[model samples]
Target chain A: MDFEDFYATSKDACLRAVMATVGSRQLAEETVAEAFARAWASWPKLSAHPAPRAWIVRTALNVHVSWWRRWRREVPAVEWTDPIQPPPDDDLPDPRLMAALRTLPPRQRQVIALRIFLDLDTETTARTLGIAPGTVTAHLARATAALRACLAPTTGQE
Target chain B: MTQDLHALVREEFQRVRLTDTLDDVTARGLRVRRRRRSGSVLSAVFALALASGVALSLPPGRAEPDSVRLAAWSVRTEPDGTLQIVIRDLADPDGLTAELKRAGVPALIEFKEVEAVTEPGRLAPHCADDGEVRSPLLLSVMVRPTGTDKRAWAIRPDAMPPGTSMHFVIFSVRDAAGKSYESVHMSLVDGDPVPCRSVS
Candidate 1:
């Protein structure tokens, strides 16, 4: 298929993949753009691969992870500097839960997003994160535990 | 409590879609498509100019004036009739020839003088020199076709600032039999060293 078709079919999946890894919608958009640029240059080869969507997702995640290396920081602490849409107020019922999410370690956050939000199976999420399925399980367990503690009601607040 | 927490986390992410529909994604892809095509065009023009200079310096009949310029070090023919070009730039012609032999291509390495192409000097936002950088220690090795004029050459970017690299350009020119000849070019420079690796 042509490039337009490829992007149309794969962009959201790519974005979800990046958001899952980076835990930020803005970062996900940036990573997706860079990955699509790479795919454009190597479309002939990438398009012919068995799993092109997976390839784009992997590349986007790698780009996100590599940005941290280039900055000499293990985590992407670079704050969003431009105008951002305010957090949607529709379905989300708790502000404290969102705050608690930002406190989790980046990898744990990724595991929770992929497993719980995007609903990827262990193996696919593992492949996306370039980790083993067992590692994904470990991260998920830790993330769930952390969230349970962080989001629990305090004696006075509830 | 565990299930409740999971539910909350899911609720948070699901609420955060970026309003990015397929149309938005397609527009982004089209932008990339334009950038890539333009990049290929620029590289093609640069390769043609470099190849033309190489053709002028060739001994009377050895060079194909109409051939494409490539930056490859060696070329090989596949069993299925596809051509594979290995790119490199070093003083050792014999090593390149050996690589071609291993790949089963009828190989010929000719040493010739050609002007090096120079970069335009604008730094990319990421600090990558816009890839317009050129140095003269460059060389080209054309792969002779056993029965056809079409061949692939490998390119090696040698000789630039420390950690600097360049890409060779390939041109598709048709020979007398309406067949295509693919030529590759590479740059080799002093002091600035090339990684002992291949750029595909």
Candidate 2:
């Protein structure tokens, strides 16, 4: 697909996927927008990829990581315990789930993002994250178990 | 239960939408492309200058007319022997250091990729803060911003104490809007000082 068509179709999904991972709608918007801009800059090569959406998500996450590293170095004393900001819209994901997701190690949150939001297979998630397939399974299992425990009372699941 | 969890995630995220338009993305993409192009061109120019050996043969005591101005940085020597250094970009720290040394100032220039720190502690990676080395005379060699994007330092070699050398650690950070800013920490080191470990 052309750049415009691809952006039109995938922008919302990409934004939601990034928001789920970052736990902040504003940061997710900026990160995903920047990633899409990068995708546009290299559309010729990126359009031919097997999973351009995955590439966008991965790029967004990488951008966030870079920014976070810089921020951490600049402000070493401040703790980044709270990443989840209140969503502007009430229809957004449950705050408890987001808090739980934010508490997971970055790798686990990334695995959940790829598997649940992007719906990528184990091998694809592994490739996107640069981790082993077995490691991907392990992270997804741990993340899911943690989220289930957090949501058990509301979901009525043991 | 797994399927249910996945469905819940998908359902909730479906409500989130991106408010930015395609035109916005395209505009930002053009900016990114332009920055990349300019960076590559600067690298090529630096490489050519280094390959020509012009950067090494800069004469002592006075800055050459051509060597006085560069796209990334400039170094000039005043009649009284004070060296003026204006940095526009942090691309070639080695060349800058060489130029400073040629101008008769014992100098170590390091362009490090570090963000500005609000808290007071270590300034750069692998470089320790030595409170003993700081002196009132070193204040004369500090770099200050002359413009919005340019920072200039004036160094009086005569005022520098014996057995002392100037060390400049430049830190660069890009804001969320993609504009780059630089901060410099100047110190007077005694004898030979160890190089700051590179973190870029």
Candidate 3:
């Protein structure tokens, strides 16, 4: 697909997927924008990937991890808090679910984001994340169970 | 239960929109492409020079002063009045900035520590721009890699617009594995200088 078309169709989904993983809309938007710019630079190579959307999401997550590390070092530990805020718009995700997702380890959140939001299959997700398929499955299982546990009260399940 | 959980999580994000226009994104992408192309050209030239053992020769009867050679960097005025700067390390940014000014190029230099994964060739986040157009400033400077931890820059002071200065932000990137390297971004600013915010 032409870059314009790919960007037009995938931009929102990519933003939503990255926002789901990072739990910060502003950061997600910035990260996804950068990732898409990078994809544009390497369009020929990226266009051939099994899952270009997954590539965009993975790149965004990587950017977030880098930012988080720098922020962690510069800021005091006591000042660190979950950055998850209630969606400012009605169409955005629930703040409670975002908070729960943020509680997962970074890898688990990434696995769930790729699997559910980007809709990458196990092998494709593993390739994009540089993890083995078995590991991806393990992370997905653990993350799903934890999210379910956290949301059980809202779901009316004991 | 797993399917239900996945559905719930997916539903939450289904309606979120990026709001940024494609034109904006593509404009940023074009900048990225230009930056990458410049880097690639420099790398290709450096490789060819190394393979051919090419060296720069000074012009005979040149009145230029002897080049200032230091452990961290070297600066020399080319015969055509351009400044050739080779940076081996990021030490003594203030001294280097002073030397560049003395050599007749208006310049400011800063070194910052950032995440190793930070993308190269992008302007440092701390530096602010004056929002003025600077096509002339872009044409006045050229940078190429000289070695593993070194870079060579050629700046034409005459080509720079009056009241404009070259601001160089050299990032010191250290990965989790303790390996580190330096990358630089040079920008042209018009009018009064904008000081970079403290990263601390």
Candidate 4:
């Protein structure tokens, strides 16, 4: 499909995917814009591919990950948390939960994002991350366990 | 933590709306591509202007200077419209042939020796008023249209004495039907000639 059609059909999904990976709205926006630019350059070559949307999404993710790594080299990772928003309250509110999520490891964050935010299955998440399905399952397991622990006290699971 | 985390992640994901706008993305992409095209055009125009200024400043003597030797070569094509040619100083006749062969062109290019034109001296009076001498020798090759009106030429910078300025010219030609294409000129100066290369 043409660029306009591609943007219309895939923009929301692409943005969500990037947001999940990068953990910042500004970075997500930048990465999505860059991905779309790259896709525009290769539109003629990618149009004939079987799944152009997937191609663009994968490209955007890769770009975001690469930028994340590069930026990591320049800046200390000690305070790698999202600066745009604050942590959640003791209550099980949506914003609080997101604040807590911003504390997870990068890979764990991406696993949760791709699986839950983008609503991709284990296999698709694994493929998107270029990892084995078992690896994806392991990351998801660790993420779920951590999140569960963080929410237990609030829900009176103790 | 699971329920809270899930809701939080969902909200965060929801907070991010798609912004890969066609108007913005495509506009930026097209702008970059057009910028590159314009850069090359500007470079070419600058080169042409420089070359014209150099050509205009030359002395208009009636005959080639005696200090330099001259040579000319032409190739004619059949009905199919394919012509190949190589021209250089007669002293270096085999050099051009060897170069063409090394470049994987056909061995039967059939180099022809036509009457020599007045050999412009590689050294000429400088543009400055100090009466400084400069080298500006030129060598040219042409693929003349046998029956058609098209003509292509490749002119090389003349090898003049030391301290002389060197100049080169390149050109291209197309047939009436536009199906036939030919390299009119690929030129070089002072030292060995390099192929056409562009950056940017």
- Model 2 Cα lDDT, one tens digit per residue, B165-188: 787777675544565655445667
Show how many residue pairs clash in every candidate, following the order shown. 22, 0, 0, 12
Per model, the share of native interface contacts recovered reads: 0.20, 0.52, 0.54, 0.33
Error of 4 at B147 (Å): 57
List TM-score per model, in order: 0.44, 0.61, 0.58, 0.43
**lDDT of candidate 3 over B1-200, digit per residue (tens):** 68988998878787888887878778778867865775686677678888999962322211133232224666777779878776655677788888888887777787788664445554323334345333433533543222112255677788778787777776676755677755455566676445554331
lDDT of 4 at B196: 27
Per-model CA lDDT versus the true structure:
0.51, 0.72, 0.71, 0.48
Clashing residue pairs, backbone N/CA/C < 3 A, model 3: none
Model 1 error, position B116 (Å): 26
Docking quality tier of model 2? acceptable
DockQ of 2: 0.28
Candidate 4: regions farther than 4 A off:
A48-54, A65-95, A152-158, B1-8, B31-200
Query: Against the true structure, candidate 2 has what lDDT?
Result: 0.72
Candidate with more favorable, higher TM-score: 3 or 4: 3
- Categorize the docking of model 3: acceptable
Question: DockQ: which is higher, 1 or 2?
Answer: 2
lDDT-sorted candidate list, best first: 2, 3, 1, 4
Of the candidates numbered 2 and 3, which has the greater DockQ value? Answer: 3
